[model samples]
Target: MKEKKQNAVTALLEYAGNYKILTFAGLTLSAISMLCSIVPYVCIWLVARELISVLPDFYKVLNVETYGWIAFGFAVLGIIFYFAGLICTHLAAFRTAENIRKIGMAHIMKAPLGYFDNNASGLIRGRLDSAANDTETLLAHNLADIVGTIVLFAGMVILMFIFDWRMGIACLLSAVISIIAMFSMMGGKNAQLMADYQAAQDRMTKAGTEYVRGIPVVKIFQQTIDSFKTFKKAIEEYSDKAEYYQGKVCRIPQAVNLTFTEGAFIFLVPVVIILVPGALQSGDFIDLVTNFIFYAVFSAIISTALAKIMFASSGIMLASTALKRIDLVMKAPTLKNCHDPQIPKDNSVVFKNVSFTYDGSSLPALSHISFKAEAGQSIALVGPSGGGKTTLASLIPRFWDVDEGCVEVGKVNVKDIDQHVLMKQIAFVFQNTKLFKTSILENVRIANPDASYDDVMRALKAARCEDIIEKLPNGAETILGSEGTYLSGGEQQRIALARAILKDSPIIVLDEASAFADPENEVLIQKALSVLCKNRTVIMIAHRLSTIVNADKIIVLDEGHIVEEGTHQELLDKGGLYHKMWNDYNQAVKWKITSEKEAL
Candidate 1:
């Protein structure tokens, strides 16, 4: 626990260190601003003291006019100081908040993908926003509070001592005692409250994202009430945490500190007034009273400042935790051994004794997998669910590196090539099509931004997307909803295929694009694939065996190992695992056709 706390503090310091100059400037401006706050109180004290003591002396010395001018000058100077501090304080606060936000966002962008996946976007947003709030509050309130309190208290103590040492000693002792009590009462409780609040916030954020993402599924199944139940529980837990912390941890301690500090001043003020007169002159007594008044005001303000600091510090702790989560993800070691992979000259990929296990998993997804596909040839991966077919395809893109062996393209280790360069040589269409909210043109353009309008049209035609395009209000200019919600599964798949076709890379990977297509859509996709596969190397994962029956080669996998490799006819002739899967698939297809005919 101690180590964690230290690490948290270190991370905060590191994050803040980037804005060292700005922080120092803020602190300096804050001190200057608070220093100005003392001007009014000091002037008030000086005026009261002189009125009680200086007027009579000045009249006796025959200098009434000069004394009047001197008092007027001091009053004007005091006002000037007060406004100067206010201006500086606000300027510092705004500047600091703006700078921190800009730097924090830049850091977030530099962070890795895993960081974003591991942490909730809301929590990250919360941290940046809260940090900005804290910075501004610290400057606008705590800065003035702390500096004003210190200057006022110090000035009061000095004046009191000049009047009488014994009274100064009493006031100093009381101030020290008050500070200790405040920290002891609230420090630990605030820390725990902040930690709990942050955890609750993250849970709520996660649940909200889940609810939004699953809303379509929930509504289709009439599961809205069940979803609400889960959401309600999350919200209730979050509220409970907030209420518990507010009552027990934050507000109570502040109330206690304020009551005790104010109450102490009441008792201390009278004691000083009663005891100081015996040891001082008339002017000295007035000075002592005025200083006591200053101390009382300073103490009240300081009490509030400390409470606020405690609260803000707790928020800072929560922010630090969020930042640490981001840091951990950004620091996760990417797969190494990549130095300079040779770009593919011909479209061929080879997996040599490849093995891989996902992070924190005990079993390998693919074990000792070896396969070869020549230039412009298609290799179909056929297997049961969880048979590592998708995993092996992912290796081609270096999504996750092979744990034990080499994955090569054109006789060069993929790890040695920069991902950017390697990606340019290949195009991938995943099982789940991902389309951003944008115009159809923009979505297809992502694969090759430099592709001309004619190129886009040709790719669209080849991918069998012209029919979907023609139905749209604006054709290629039509804006799609997020993840292409407006399009059917087959339509979206064809759009994705259009994108790959637009890319025109020599190597192409298709992960079950036909898995969800009906007979009509399937026929369209098959036609599109035939055109797209021309003069390109293709590796496809297929659940519908018929789609890949004519693939140049087919590899059958089960339990992380390839059980057989042969052409479709050759595999059937062997009468092994492939033969059985193919037979079952044929029977299912025939049964579906016969049932449809009978119904009609």
Candidate 2:
């Protein structure tokens, strides 16, 4: 039951979809342009004929001016048709690119957050956006030219035979050889080579982006460009491979193709002379010479036409590779939505024997874990670094569906509930706070767009952001990430809390929400959390055990299993992982105090 693999051309056309009508129009116009393109050549032939008819008389041909005007008219028509074809093709190409990017973005939105964890953002952007751009160039610029050149090839063949079939064959000798050379050069092992090129480019792009984003750390560490292993290696590998590939594979064929095509007429002169006695000796002598003249004139143009084909073929290969990469993005699975979605009756959260494995991993991240946070209670998850605290909390919101067992909110399985409705019931505050590039007020208001300016202000105040806002020249109107109004980590963390407060969902999941807070902001953030978590079913993850000491329950986890669950003192009484972690935390706090006093 294997899926059939689509060729690159077919895949690209499928992506084009309904927009192909524009492509068809472009092709039709391009074909017309090709016919028109030969009109000037035809004019030359006609003028030659008239000139020969009045040989040495020089003034016998009347209305000779008419043919010149007609030739000019045909030339204008050819240019107009080609321009129109380009316009149509370009329109289709741009639209196709936009649609693919938009569609890819929409799929990424619906994909599991784990997808982001495994895939680099730069790699994804480079593959999708670069593919779209390559496709646009192929269809908008290359395809139109390809179609025009094909039509010209056909017209040239027909006209050559009409003039004289023997010399027609002679005229195409160089083109045929060039075509064979191109096929030999670009065909065998081409698929794998193109794929390798694309993969190398993607790796280089990912490394470049990572290096740029990490420049601050690099500068702080006083690292040289050569010390950035990934970036340096990627650049060198890409450069070396590209150089090797071009030098080894292309040099001979390209030189051969170019030389023979440009010199096709040289071969023709000897061939025509050899065939004249048999082919054109019985024909009128003047007619024979005239046809030879036409062939001589067309030989260079044939070379140009053949060259266009080679260029188009190269673009096709690149575009095909791009299309294949884009297809991979399109094929990524989205989270399934329930057809008959259930509604939750209350704000209680439950995980029952849930086992989950991350994509491309053999071991389960969470194994047969069970937990509950009853309505109007805050249950904090405490564990070592590799414990399943985040994974367990993530299950309730269906960030990933459990491979075994169910996660329920208010007695209904989370997967059975409508995704949007389920999201509406929960508010999330992550350790890494995310704020849009907008005003502080607008960022808070994103939680509830319908929330008024007054509502946002109240949330900001509750999250302890009043002092930060007051110092800004534009107050709430100042944009984030622009101008000179950048906030520290603690400040952004408060804004995140403000967003959660504004959301006011019945269920709140906080993953190390105050991890970024400075001492002064920590107290303010604690106050904000107390307000935001009031009467809500809260599932929180905190690295700082002191912050979660007053939770209704603390669940201690280790290596994908819950080791113990009870009140703070209750877990301390058990003398397990939690108890040891608590004892260590207290000793760390004492050491900090002792160190500070000694420094003073």
Candidate 3:
């Protein structure tokens, strides 16, 4: 058990990294300060001895002025040293926190898209930020408190023996009991409990975020907050767990610990009174009583010191949990790149009998999916939902490496190309457009930050977003989601298209760019898409069968396998899956409301 705790402490100190030197300096200074703090008590004992030597003639105490001056100086120096130590520790702590946050964000940026798919943005932000902040708190104040308390406790023990071992033992017994109470309360079971508590907190945060984002759907369905099962369940479970921990798990031990620590004097006075009479002569007994007073006064300091130690103990436990959470992201594998990278000579995309399974899943997302999209050709992947249309398109961008076979560009394996170079060669327009809370012009210019105002205007015009810019009060300078300057789904899509157009990459990947467009905006977005796709090699995943009728090639997939492949007319003649889907789509379009049919 002792070894386990030592290991945890070692891990935390190791994580301090470059700041360890500063931490060591702080600890050393804090120990010096603690020594100073205790020296004043020794001075007080000396003054007491001088007064005792004078006996009835109280005014004749020898060198009283010298003892008084020395004691005052020790007290003052303790405060100064404590302050200096804090300055060093806090500075080192801030630096450590900054580095951790930077390292965490860098890792997330390089992680695979599949990691994002399986985790919610809110969960990631909450867990990682909490972990970083917890570590910061530990380093900033908790660590100093911990080191100071240990030093103070050691000083008190040594002085106890020097003054009188019997009295020292009496004073030390009170501290031992307090320590026992603290440790017993947070026994072996607390580790698992702490883990459970953190998990519950994360679940509650995720559920709450999901509820807010889905509020529109909830209102449309006439749903009450209480009716949201996941959110409600999360709140209930978190509340229950917290209540159980506070009210039942550690409640008794905590109460006993606090009581014993705060009232240590109550346990001391009786023992002192009993010992004063029987141990020695009147003069010696007076000396023993004076030393007991030393123990009594220092007991208060001991209680305060141990309180700080207990807080540091809690910080250490919490930091252990935070580190485990951080390790999940830090240790996740990134896309591997070859030492010698090769450039693709052309924009042609090919899947050479590829297979892929999602992380933490047994079934393949795409299996044996072989196809070719030659340079300057528009290829559309159309299929039922969950049939791997989007998954196959994602592989081309190296979002996830294939489990079997390979995906290539210009006959070179995509894995062999540098990630930044691979990304520079392709542009994506997702169905759900994401815009930062920035000016319209800046959001559009994200594709090429170096592009000037005129260049951004050109791309916006090509994507048919001129009308959106004209309507905003600040024209293109207006901030998104501010001052009623928000755009509808269709407008956001066009702005996204403008971003893609600005990219001007050799390959364009569109995932139903017009999925949320109204009948009016659909035609405009389609027109913009035509402009974007004019000469680039395109791979599109569209739910709308009619829109991709003129695509250079259509691949129909089902359950991770390609079932059919052809153009509009050729597939219709073959009477295959695409032909059946086309006929079904036309029937749905022709269907109408009963009232419209009756009126007609």
Candidate 4:
């Protein structure tokens, strides 16, 4: 079964939920207001009829003042209704936008953590926050205007033929031409161009965010804006899209639309001239003049109505594109939870014939791989870059689900375990640690929210962060990444270790945790690792071979396959891939030492 495609207005109304009633009420009121507005024009015709019937005997026009007051009253009533309609729409529009943002965020929160790696935070925020704002204009003002204009047009059609059909046809011709021109700008291939223009805008927003985030790198490299090629390209693409849509696509159609829309009375003058001889022959020149006055005044509203349609149509297209972008974020894959979740019996982790590939990729990141880290065992994964070390580590946490086979903890498949329970069993510390801009106490307490202040203090002490805390003014209460209280990369790494220590999970997955630390910090990080790894089933990935030489088991991976697995000394004796990598690492370390001494 295929799903029914909803129009933009209908899709947006879904987000309104209970507020949809307000939107309907607003449209109804707007239509009634438009009908009321037409009464004044009818009154003008009646006033003209009375005055012309008495021809130069102006005082004989007894109903002229009555008609004037009626026109004034209807005009005032129209304004009040219009304003009241706007109030209803504005309230609904605000709630609709709020719901869009709230629903988008809630959906995104359920998405897998790995999704953020491919989708930039800026792009997601722009889609949810800014795109929702775009829809507000459509719902608040454009929708009401559209409804009012439609009602006005329907009433105009009936009134047009009532006086003189010929004059009515002439007045309607301009509106017909204007409608055609407006649709030409929005319909067919041009609709696709508008969508492309919006896509380019999204790309520019994403690129701008990436450029801003990389500004520090740019400054460090002494580079200019031109050096940020992606941002520059995105800007150029957006400009080109805007230029092409406005200059090439919309230029002629827009001109035609505006010319016909504003000049709706253009055809009325010639039609009245043609009808003059017949009126004179029928001795009804007074009627002709009166009907001409009515049509002429009515033509003015043709311009207002057509202009509303043009802008309203534009709003519809913009909102439709915005909803599509929101859909992209909402469609992100989320980790599926088992209905009957099972708890793991033990801390032992095992992989059985596991093979996984990233989305949109042909080759597997890990192929037919099997390994185990028994409770309290330390297993180190070491290999060249892109050897599936990080990918394998990520699988244990179900960052990306496996394409084949299963990962088990305590003999229970990870997919069968409750996501929250699974997360509680393992703690991960990556090379690039992220700390929120909050107090140090809060940052560490995130790992174990129920843990007491004393427990956090003990974890920090165990992670060898005493020196870091002592140097700060407020100790654990000091805010990080603000007020000049920023920690060095190594210091941040130690703090991350403290977080993991506070978590106190039986399984710890460390991915190049000390890769960015300076030599002094490296020593401190190693000491912290010792405390963290104690009595835990540790799965460590490291480029620094020295750190993992003493592991109970070392696994060497290459091109998604495990090439060798054994104790470090046993692998060294075997002279396999691990042995060769160890030799290369030793040569690099010796070269670094000699280079430093020579430089001194």
Best by lDDT: 4
lDDT string, candidate 3, 127-173, tens digits: 57767777776777777888888888888888888877877777777
Candidate 4 lDDT, 396-444, residue by residue in tens: 8888888899999877999999889999999999998999999999999
TM-score per prediction, in order, is: 0.80, 0.94, 0.94, 0.93
Superposed model 3: Cα runs more than 4 Å off = 1-16, 212-225, 279-282, 596-600
lDDT for residue 45 in candidate 4, whole number 0-100:
97
Better model by lDDT: candidate 2 vs candidate 3: 2
What is the per-residue lDDT of model 2 for residues 129-231, given as tens digits with 9 covering 90 to 100?
Answer: 9889988878887777788898899999999899888788988888888987786666666545645665787689878988999999999999988879999
Q: Candidate 1: lDDT over CA atoms?
A: 0.71
Per residue, candidate 1 scores C-alpha lDDT tens digits across 264-287 of: 466456667686866385546666
RMSD of each: 5.1, 2.9, 2.3, 2.9
The residue pairs in collision within model 4 are none
lDDT of 3 at 56: 86
lDDT of each: 0.71, 0.85, 0.84, 0.90
Runs of candidate 4 exceeding 4 Å displacement: 1-6, 212-236, 593-600
Error of 4 at 342 (Å): 1.2
The runs of at least 3 residues in candidate 2 whose Cα sits more than 4 Å from the true structure, single-residue gaps closed, are 1-6, 62-64, 119-123, 275-284, 593-600
Give the candidate order by descending lDDT. Answer: 4, 2, 3, 1
